[model samples]
Target chain A: MLSVNVRLFGTLSRTFEDYHHSCGLDIAIASRGDIHDLLVHLDLIGESIGMVFMDDKQVNNTTKLNDNARIKIFQPIFGG
Target chain B: MNIVRVDMNARKITREIFEPAFTGMGGRGLTSFFINREVPPGCDPLGPDNKLVFAPGFFSGSTLVNTSRFSIGAKSPMTRGIKESNVGGTVAADMARTGISAIIVEGRPNNGQSFILKVDQKGDVTLHDADQYWGKRTYDLVASIKEFYGNKISITCIGPAGEQQLSAASIQATDRDGRPCRAAGRGGLGAVMGSKGLKALIIEKSATNAEPIQDLEGFKASAKIFAKAVMDDEFSAEILPELGSAVLVEPINAAGAFPTRNAREGQFEDADKISGEALAQIIKSRGGKPNHKGCSGCIINCSNEYVDEKGEFITSSLEYETIWSMGGMIGNNDLDSIARLDRLCDDIGLDTMSTGVAVAVAMDAGYKEFGDAKAAIEMVEDVARGTAFGKILGHGPEMVGKHFNHDRVPVVKGQSIAAYDPRAIQGMAVTYSTSPMGADHTAGWVVDSNLEAFGGTLDPFSAQGQVENSRNTQIHMAMVDTVGICDFAQTGFGAPDGLENVCKMIAAKSGKPFCEADWKSTGKMIIQTELEFNKNAGFTKEQDRLPRMFYEEPLPPHNKVVVIQDDDMDSTFAF
Candidate 1:
């Protein structure tokens, strides 16, 4: 099993009432789990995800996760 | 459609049929084309020779959703170049419904007096002596106008900043609620209006005369499809309506492009406190209105009414760019202070983006410490008071930078750059450097296409596809602005057959064929005209480059500097 840290931003964070923005959430997943598997575990499937970053680099749902990986998820954003 | 020409010097108003050559033109297309042909490129922007034009989008008065956009054009006193500052308010629809295509204000008043132009329900134009409103701020002036001229009208006016002919002055327009919070807020066009001795333009909201559409049924069908698509898109339908444009704060910060402390840093430690999530949460807690509609026929409702802790109204809409300018750019994190600053800028008739960045530049130069919200507020208030330092701040970042001898000022052609940092997003570097409108993010918002998570094809830090992406996006955005489509609602164009549906609507209204190809060409024509004016006005490829800071200093987190070559920037307009 691999432990991944996840941080949600914008409206996505509001879904988890007790979610800490700075501290993020820690979850253990299978060693071969990708972003899709991680989203499923977090119950974020079908959510309007704007961008996702793993260790500071943007990643898609199909990208595989590694041990101690840090993930940040955001709602779709439009600029002014 | 008719054009109303007001000669300020003669105090004469005349109505004539719009030029036959501009049959299908509207908004920026009409404004740019007119300014290019009539105004000399080298003419002083604040002199008698300059003209201020107001034009609504073709779909403004039609039964289309989210089309209340208008273009206010003039030679910029700041950039010294052609400018079409687009704004959204009830005035666009009201003006269009009066069957007036454009209102052109020409020449300066010989008597050095101020006046207001009133357009009645019958579309008759008249000029009135407005000496009483000469130095009033926008909020007070708007209330006075409503008290005197009834509440059922839309007003576009300038405040003390414009009256002073400040380079960062903006023309404030009334929103759906009769609040003059919407602004044609760039290029210092309000200074042009003030120089012409025009204080305000009042249009009767009761006017119901709309231009005839050739195929009403077909237009309505396409309109419905476009509206549905806007309602269906995730960014337009859900996130924006829930969080407003402030939703960009977190994602952009995460991308290492939030631009903090006058672009000295890429990220602000306190960014989350001022982000969309926090903004919406605070509004909800304070009993303010979220999901507020700011413009006519807008279904996205991305605007919000910000209130004090006691639940009293402070500002109509606290936007993302203002949040950054007053927040991270100046190294401040208090949302309440930012909201108040937004109201102050709106009241003073100044561009919040420019005003904030000017203060940022001042803070960077050690005039005041960064994160000093009190000092920032005082500086903005000084612009209204016309204090000596206030005069310097009102002219925007370049002037402020010069005043303090600051070398890190992030600007292009006198105008301050927006929220996105070009170092982190190299595509934006190309757009910021090449766009006729200097450092304007909206001129070509290539942020989405540069991020992989947004299904972007290019790398954000690489220069490989940056120039081409910016060029295509800039051309498309030109057409979008000409059509007066709200940038947030442009997601409708992404739906299957959405672009074609828009074309069909155009054809139905103009009784002419319009396709994707024509869209590109029309956009290209508008850019070419603007470029020609700038070229003649003595702008060269050298003026298109970003400041030395962007290329020399590497932004943190990503630790990347701008890598786009100068030759690549010059190639953007190579049709």
Candidate 2:
């Protein structure tokens, strides 16, 4: 199993309110899957998440995450 | 609507018709136009020659959501360049209701004959003596004014810091609750207001009519669709209320771009303690008002009324920048202390970003230890009390660095950069160096552009392709500020149909041919004019470079440095 650290921000992690401080989780993904697949596996809707960062750089659905890659998800936040 | 000209040197008030060139313009468009045309280049920003122009946005007086924002423009005493700062509050709404295109305050008062100018509902303007209110805290001053002139009026005034003509002073404006909270908080415009010796601008709430719309029905249709888009967006409706812009804390920290300890590091060890979710949890536990609107027509309500653990209000709209500035950037994890610092900045009328960054620089110079909340709060007290030490800090980060002989100052064009660190966000590096407004986050926010999922397709760690990212986003933000709506309301404006809806509103309001493409073009024009003004004011492409420290030091955990090349930055405005 391949593992990735996922962190959701803004409304993207609202459902996990109980885990506010620990919204970041280490989850397993299939070797054949990408970020979209990982989102689906985690029961998260992709459209609700605005920007996706992999190890502090932006990533796309097709960007393959190797084992233990870090992912940060944020709602399309605009205000400063 | 006409222009009201108040001559402070002459102590005369005269109403003048706006020139044909400026008739339909408002917000940044109007403010920049007036400033670029009227004020001579290279004049002292605090001298008698500089004129302060205040103009409400085109849609401000209407029933539009998030349109209650106005622009204040002058040559910056801080940056010594053209500056336009916009704020959200009832002032814009009330000022628009006063039936004025812009209010131009020119000339300096002689003989210390200071007065508060009142623009009443019936278009009557009067100047009243304001001697007794000098040197008062902004909240108390506002309360006393509200009590005297009814609780409904909106006011814009500077505090004792401004009265002292400190470069970091900000012009405070009243929010709906009569708190002198919202601020046009950049470029030391408050010092400009102080130089004029005009104590306050009281805008009486009197207009009951909506702004005249050419295509009223069409505007209504577009507005309804846009409002629904805003209200229905998950970010605006859910996260904004739940956490506010402070939501960026966790994600930015996780990404190692949150600007910890005055940009020395990209991440904070105590990030979770100051995260928006943590703040929201605290507010909830303390029964503090969470998810409040900062302005009259704001739909997102990204602002909040932060309170102490005793459930007393501390500050309104304690923003992400403030949180990072006083929290992560200064190494302070105490949210209550940060809240107190926020209140201190607001009440004393100082730019929170500049104040926080200056204090951080002082800490770097061994003035105090990092993470000392007591020391940080005391520095603010020094500013409010106008101490000799406070005078040095009040000059902003550049001066603070100079005073302490520290070389690692984080600033661009004498203005301190905001929360987002350039080492992690290369697009932001371009913005920090190139923005005519000097390192402002709102001038060009491109965190999304670095994400390929949103069409960025650029590597954020290097100099490659970040110029176009910063340029496009900067132009877009120029249009956003020109339109005078809250930046969070871009949820509506960012959607596929958002531009069409916005164009319809502008066309209906201005009775002109407005289209989606005009946003970029008009935005480009405003930026070009500002750049030209800055050039004439003696700014070189050299000043458009980030501090040496940014490029010299590698920020962890990414361990990247500022790599955006110089030629690309110069081409940002080449068009």
Candidate 3:
């Protein structure tokens, strides 16, 4: 099993507050799992997660996940 | 589109035809062009020679979303430079529907009597004495006018701060709910309006149709595509309309870029307490508007009607910057207090950001204690009352810093910096230092996506590639402002084809040739005009750099200082 540290941003914290407490949630995934698998496991609104950053770099939904990968999800936010 | 010129000194008004020289120009484009052409560089901002021009954007009055941006221009009493402050509300759309492209108020009244400029339903302009309304709070004044013009009227006015000719005053505009929450704030343009003896500009809801589009079918197709893209974006659809602008508090805080306690710290411990998530929770429990439409045609709906504990409306749009400025910057964690301060700013007609920074500077200098919510409210009320102490606080951060002899004044060219700490986001340092508007965030905002989308490769902690990044974003934003697109629509504009569609809409509307190629060139033209205006007003390379405190003080969390060099700033206008 591979584990990734994930933090949700904006409305995501509220959506997944039961699991994450605030914004961060630690999840274990199968070997070579991608962002799709993570989103499925979390059961978050798929379209709402516009950008996914794996270790401070942008990645797509199909990008491969590795052991202990740091992930942060951002919704589309403008204005301030 | 006609230009209505009101000569206050002679008590005469004239309607002149919009010139071909300023054709295809609206909003900041027209205001800046007209100011640079007419107003002398060295004239006093509050003098008769300095004119106050208000013009709506190109797509205003049209069936366009997010085109209700009003550009108010003048020689700034705060920065002593040509300034154009953009506001969002129903005023821009309603004023544009009057078939008047711009309202230019010139000269000064001898007796210094207050007056209101009214444009009726039939496109007629008249001046009315404002003796009863003068010195009143903007919200009350707006309500008084609403009684006369009824609900369909849109108003742009100032409060006692402007009446007292404070340099930090902002001209407040009525939002969709007739609340004076939308403001053309920054650069003391309100003082110019006050100087002209004008209290407010009341526009009756017009019966006229949208601006004539040259290629109607083509424009419709392009506009449909653009509107669909904006409305379809995940951020626009889910985050903005749901949580409003305050939602930015978390992501920015998580990224270690949220400025706190006057930029002494990069991240605040109480960030979540004053965040959009918490704000939403509070609004839910209090049972007020969770997501309110701020402007006339704002599809994003990124503003909220904040309510008190009793579930009464206190203010509209307690946005991220305002939350950060009034909350973390002053070390105050109370969201309700911050909401009240936002309300005070709207009512008193002052820049919330400037007012916050000023209070922060004063607190740092021992005028008040940090985290003292009562003291913060008192300080703000001082500005409203026009007291001697209030006058110091009303002069904005730089002057307060000078008065208290405190060195850590976070300002660029006299205007206060926004919520983002420059040290954490080095690209913002470039934007704040070199933007012709002086420390304005809207000139160009750099989030993580902005770096990747614009092809900018830079270490945000260090100085590499930041100058280029700032230059590119600044130029692109200039085009957006000139063409009258809202920054929130960047969810669409940031897409590969997003900005192209924006240019397409403009080209279709005016029958002009503009695409991505012209985007950068058009932005350059507008920026050059602004830079020329600033240059003539005695701003040189020295004024184009960030304050020394930003360079010396190391912000916590990342512990990075603003390392962008002055040499890089000199090249910002090299284009």
Question: DockQ, in order, for the candidates?
Answer: 0.59, 0.43, 0.33
Model 1 pairs whose backbones collide: none
Q: After TM-score superposition, what is the CA distance of residue B437 in candidate 2 from its true location, in Å? A: 1.1
Superposed Cα deviation of residue B321, candidate 1 (Å): 0.6
Global lDDT of each candidate: 0.90, 0.84, 0.83
TM per candidate comes to 0.97, 0.94, 0.92
lDDT of 1 by residue, B318-378 (tens): 9999999999999999999999999999999999999999999999999999999999999
| lDDT, candidate 2, B219-332, per-residue tens | 788888888888887777787888988988877776678898888899898987888977887888888877886788878777788888788899998888999999998999
Full ranking by lDDT:
1, 2, 3
Candidate with top TM-score is: 1
User: Cα deviation of B377 in candidate 3 (Å)?
Assistant: 0.4
Ordered from best to worst DockQ, the candidate numbers read: 1, 2, 3
- Which stretches of candidate 3 lie above 4 Å from their native place? A1-7, A13-40, A43-73, A76-80, B20-23, B449-456, B494-496
What is each candidate's fraction of native interface contacts (fnat)?
0.64, 0.50, 0.38
Order of quality (TM-score): 1, 2, 3
Clash count for each candidate, listed in order shown: 0, 1, 1
Worst 10 residues of 2 chain B by lDDT: B16-25
Better of 2 and 3 by lDDT: 2
